[model samples]
Target: MATYSRNRLTQLLPFILSLLLLGLNSGQVQAAPKAELWPLWQPTVATGQSAVPDFKHWENFLSQYVRRYADGLNRVDYASVTPADKAQLKALLEQLSTTDPRGWGPATQKTFWINTYNLAVVSLVLDHYPLDSIRDIRLSFSSLFNGGPWEDKTLSVTGQELSLNDIEHRILRPIWPDRRLHFALNCASVGCPNLATQIYRVETLDQQLDAAEQDFLRNNRAVLWQPGSNTLQLSSIFNWYQVDFAANENQLLDYLQQQGAVSPGILSTPDLKISYDYNWNLNTDS
Candidate 1:
């Protein structure tokens, strides 16, 4: 009996050792050093600095590359980016990374972060273009830590390595607190807000934000009024950022109506059923 038990233990040992090795290699065990945590507030305006950084080059890139589809989805012509265009984008990002945003005002800071998020997304997709959806890019190591390309620490801004998630969640939403920001920061997904054909500017930030809200609301893809069920459906963005809509359904409806996202007739009905939906497909030109 002892001899048989010893043989059985020997047989199981190799299998158990293999499993442990696999866990370590997969980053599930023997954890690596933790990455730097994203900050709650990105560095904002400091005293005695210029108000707004020039965005002329960024505007030029957007004007040249972004196109509005008939379906209202703004698709980027990333496949056509030349070496010069890539160089220009790199230079712009480098400048943004090194520049301190502390002296900028609210409007300027808003525009700057919005542009940073959008441009960073474009740059990432450009790095792996020809893919069907942004979802295809997974920067995580294990399925346990699975996240989109947004998780990558692609930018070193103000001395801290930042990801798209940091730019969007930590900086933009908290700093601005304007729900219309959802319409300005494109996610390169079909359900996301349209990528503006022009760069966001501090001077025209309000108008641009208002226009984005109106444009998105006007599109059937964003606000679908189901006649058969007499229900109003909104983009999943509202559901995810419900707190941003003043933490109530009525406020969301009112805000949408205020932005002309839903017609008055559809919005007039009290106790209307609201559902949120989103599409994750790439917003490519069809």
Candidate 2:
């Protein structure tokens, strides 16, 4: 009986350990308090992609409203936007709503989604301007928990409503799986990747994405080396999306090195520990 039990235990150990790891990864072990989902994600289809989205209006909006600071932070002046400009913004959104992204090429698809997600966020913030941060704008009565505007699906497109999370997690990340997007999607927060000052064009999508990645990697928010303690601290993004970054710490380091964000000297250090951190404060113009 003892011999039989020992063999059974060994056989099940791997499966049991895998379950435990999965649970931990899913945040079941120490789950953060998340706001309740108002309405769950619904399936939506992109229209057949044909014409390139004319981002002229979006470009004008960015040039007029977004201010770039010396620290690489871009802030949108939601308060200062005139009524006529807002109309243009609305019309631009409406154009996107009517356009189908189904048959678009990868570049066109990515540009459309990224721009749509960003514009939707801006429109949300503008709807309730004068707030310190985007997190302050919560659903009716859901403000008790400090829930943000992300869950609210305020735009209708392709016969379905869309939210910031839906456009990002559901469509962009799942479809593209590009970690560089972590730097492209702005959360109207200082901790998030800086909002691009210019509009994203399908023609220059690769260059734009590469530039964004390089800029973020060099930023202190994404990486830090504490020579005093021999510790390398990475952005919480790597922690949250480790699979997208790499399979292990060494591979992550290699990725950073390849991006020219880190040096061989940092990689050569022994007995180093890794930690992750993020900031959630609003990225507003003071």
Candidate 3:
């Protein structure tokens, strides 16, 4: 009888472990910041000549430091950044901080915020250089679980102090509510969508966004299918912001199919299992 009991426990271990992992992943998804609109950002003007701010400095910076590798990742040469280049980055951030984007159109505002988020990430990573991952630079004890400097107020935009979370969750997500924007904002992490070498412009914003989404989806990091196991693996971005993508798992598969990111045959398999994962290693040109 004792031998039978021991065998039963052994048989149940894998199932038990799977349940625990699912719970942990679910907790992380639940812990992701929700989109909450800040009222002050709602106002916008009908017409303005100087609505779009200059991105020449940003363009120059990107040209100098950002490099796109054959692996479909745009990595920054963070270690090679000189003091002068760092000052230029700081100048760009300062320019963005004082510029009031509320007076601009949504397209311009969207582009601005996306660039701001990506730039801020690079800046933060540089400040705490020689780290294995962005997750290593903890702002507080809670950061161990909360993750990096995302929660700390790192930028002042139009007199309103904002964090990376504020830019992504509060302003960008709430204002746009487009899943494609997820591909546009880079977190200086390997699992994140590639940081564009070219600056996002008002004229090409729509095309740029569409291209970003398509590019990310095509990469194995975003979606992978296991034919033998009939399992579908997706980036944790889809899991974290599921509402932005689809209403349910089936809808998500449909969405992927519509994007031409996944093959219909694989998505149509009977009783297919889905999994989510993300890598947080620093996206640096080593």
Candidate 4:
């Protein structure tokens, strides 16, 4: 984001004052003062294959927003983020993804990775809203890029020229190691977790992820818990990554029992719900 200080914003406030007045007079809402000129990202070429991005400044700026304005559990009121805001968010993701993210502090790297993942997912949804899944925006026939996740996506991350999956699966998972990531990584579908309103703060990323998981579980959004039956009903994520969740407990129900407060009786019951109905539709409120 470009730097316009409070003093500068105040100086320019009069110019934008007309926008505010217009909103007051008309029913249409005015955009935030720091709105972007281009709804999509403007590409940068300095993204060296050998270099990583420095996220110190980015971390500081985002932290300020989290501390000063974000509400509990990192949930920003969904109604506030209009479609236009998502367009700006899409652009921001491009900038962050292509930019080298090295030379920053550890916390910054962690937070930046989390934010980038969330933004990338959101951006995909906005352009292809009304789709049934993130798969709708296939890598093979990308409108933006002519490749897929299986192809070589040479982007800089933590000083390495790794693919996007490398950053998410290899680099970030080892650093953060939290289960709540399921919520933050939007797949532009109903089955994927809900997008958090506030940017993930490095200072409280774990807490944020935890709250995110709880949000999903509490609503039976992805997994449902049955106390009487002692059975755990969960999403296909557990079915897909049997290895990730099936270690000591060895089954999906076991993983849920470990993650949930419910005891170990549901696995024996047939009444357990195992539906993983994910919608791949675009995430626009409309």
Candidate 5:
């Protein structure tokens, strides 16, 4: 009897392991990170005069390497980046590190943070080029299971070291709490909104943000409506940051309609099946 029991357990091990893995993944998906403010990043007006850091170098780098293909996604020509341009990018980041934006106006501050986040993402990807996904660039074993480089304190701003998560969740999201900002910040993945070719500026930040949100919503990667099956497929971004977007599914549908992401009929569809998915493939022009 003991020999027979051992054989049965061995045969079921794979299936049991699969079930356990699936449960863990489901929990991970449902538990999205909240936007909690980190007091360290709180802005205070500096007595000394300060100027918004110029992003002309960053803009030039984007103009040279980023291209919007027919697929509607902005792909970075990472492999073709010249060493001179890469050095310029490094210099741009170094310049941003020393500059303090606390004395800057709200518009200038938001523009600075958005551009910095995007620059950091691109820089990180260049450091680990030829990777299939950003998630593959794991710094630690824990990063392999959780966030990749996002949790690492890789960026220095105003003498404070911060990770990508610190910028997005702690600073930007908490300070602004604007859903449109989500489209403005790119994650270097196919699922993320396009990284704008032009650098965000204080003068044109609002218009640029509006355009970014509209462009992403119009793209099939952000929202897909299957009329035949009455199914709504959305990017996992909406699932992860649902609180930022709306209170519930109906309100979410209303918000989507307002953005022209879907038709008004979608709000009335009975037995509507909603599913969320995201592609983690590197947005590269290969």
Candidate 6:
């Protein structure tokens, strides 16, 4: 019996190491994050098949169109975008809105809608570029951003009328049990998490979002300044969506301190100088 036990333990050791390696490499994405930018694409999910999309299709598409849009910013002298491009993109969004991924579940649907909201926002910006922010784009009367109903927006997800805020504030954030998601929904500001190069998947979402929040918080470029400073310069996200974070905590600084790592401690900047920094430039290969 003792010999049998020893042999069984020996067999399990290698199996344990193999599982550790699989976990270390699996679902760990180093690229950018998926946000409210892609309005109609489903998150890249593992179909349990070897041939899975790491977002190559959408990345290629975005690369081409974003470059053209950026060119519009600098040189108005290129081959103008035909209405065809707009029509094609819009058609694709519509397809995403109606797609029913077989064997895929509700979580899949939720992630898909979130991605769609963001994609639609990006398209909206490109349509009205040479502008400042997403807030500049006017939603239809009674749309989510402008004191309107959740639906009836120009952006459609899975064949339903959904406003950007509805997808973000209503379905994905509230109903979903995952908390790491604070990272993926961008409002098109410099302070927001850099939109990921790939789409998000429900299976891999927790890992992806946790990684995103940590990366953004650690980096000084997107979010800066000392909590102890008399003047605190923070991400514009805090300024724009203060209410989302306010109820749980009394103030924004408290939220920062909770997330921040200080040598000694965090100091409340009494009459602290709060500055918002964000660049509305396109986030492409640059």
Which candidate number would show the highest lDDT if scored against the true structure?
Answer: 5
TM-score of every model versus the real structure: 0.78, 0.76, 0.86, 0.56, 0.88, 0.57
lDDT of 1 by residue, 49-108 (tens): 643557677788889888988888887787788878877777777777776675666676
Candidate 4, residue 274: the lDDT equals: 50
True-vs-predicted CA distance for residue 71, candidate 3, Å: 1.8
Model 6: weakest 10-residue lDDT segment is 69-78
lDDT of 6 by residue, 166-283 (tens): 6676566555534445567655544456555456777887677777776666666445566555545555555555555565324666666677722113344355565655554334
lDDT tens per residue, model 2, 1-286: 9999999999999899668544433331122222223233322354444576687877888888789778766777777888888887788777776776666566777888898888877777777777766766766543323246664676766657777767777777776778888888887877677888898887788899889888788887788899989988887777766677899878988998898777888878888877777665666675
Taking the candidates one at a time, how many backbone clashes does each contain?
Answer: 5, 2, 0, 17, 0, 15
Off by over 4 Å in 1: 1-45, 48-53, 142-147, 267-272
Ranking by TM-score, best first?
Answer: 5, 3, 1, 2, 6, 4
Q: How well is each residue in 1-286 modelled by candidate 5, as lDDT tens digits?
A: 9999999999999899668544543342545568998887777775336667778888998998999999899999999988888888888888878888877777778888999999989988988888877876777655635645777887798878888889999999998889998999998989899999999988888999999999999998999888888889998899899999999977887899988888877867898899888887899989
Q: Highest TM-score, which number? A: 5
Off-target runs (Cα >4 Å) in candidate 2 are 1-52, 140-147
Q: Across residues 1-286, which tens digit of lDDT does each residue of candidate 3 receive? A: 9999999999999899668544543343445789999888874774554445677877887888999889888888999999888888888787766678887777878888888888888888888998878877778655545666778887888878888999998899999999998999998888899889988988899999999999999998899888788889999998998889999978988999999988898877998999988877899998
Any idea what lDDT model 3 has? 0.84
Model 3 worst lDDT run, 10 consecutive residues: 21-30
Clashing pairs in 3: none
lDDT of 5: 0.85
- Name the regions of candidate 3 deviating beyond 4 angstroms: 1-30, 47-52
Stretches of candidate 4 exceeding 4 Å from the true structure: 1-87, 139-164, 225-232, 248-252, 261-265, 268-277
RMSD list, candidates in order: 7.5, 11.7, 8.1, 17.1, 4.5, 22.1
lDDT digits (tens) for residues 1-286 of candidate 4: 3456877888988878557534433321222111122211222343434334343433333333222112122222233445656555544544554565444556666677776665554444445555443444554433123212322343443334544455556656555555555566654445556666566776787788787776666555466665665455566555544444455344655656676734556555666545333333434433
TM-score of predicted model 2? Answer: 0.76
- TM-score, model 1 to reference: 0.78
Q: Assess candidate 4 and give its lDDT.
A: 0.49
Error of 1 at 139 (Å): 1.7
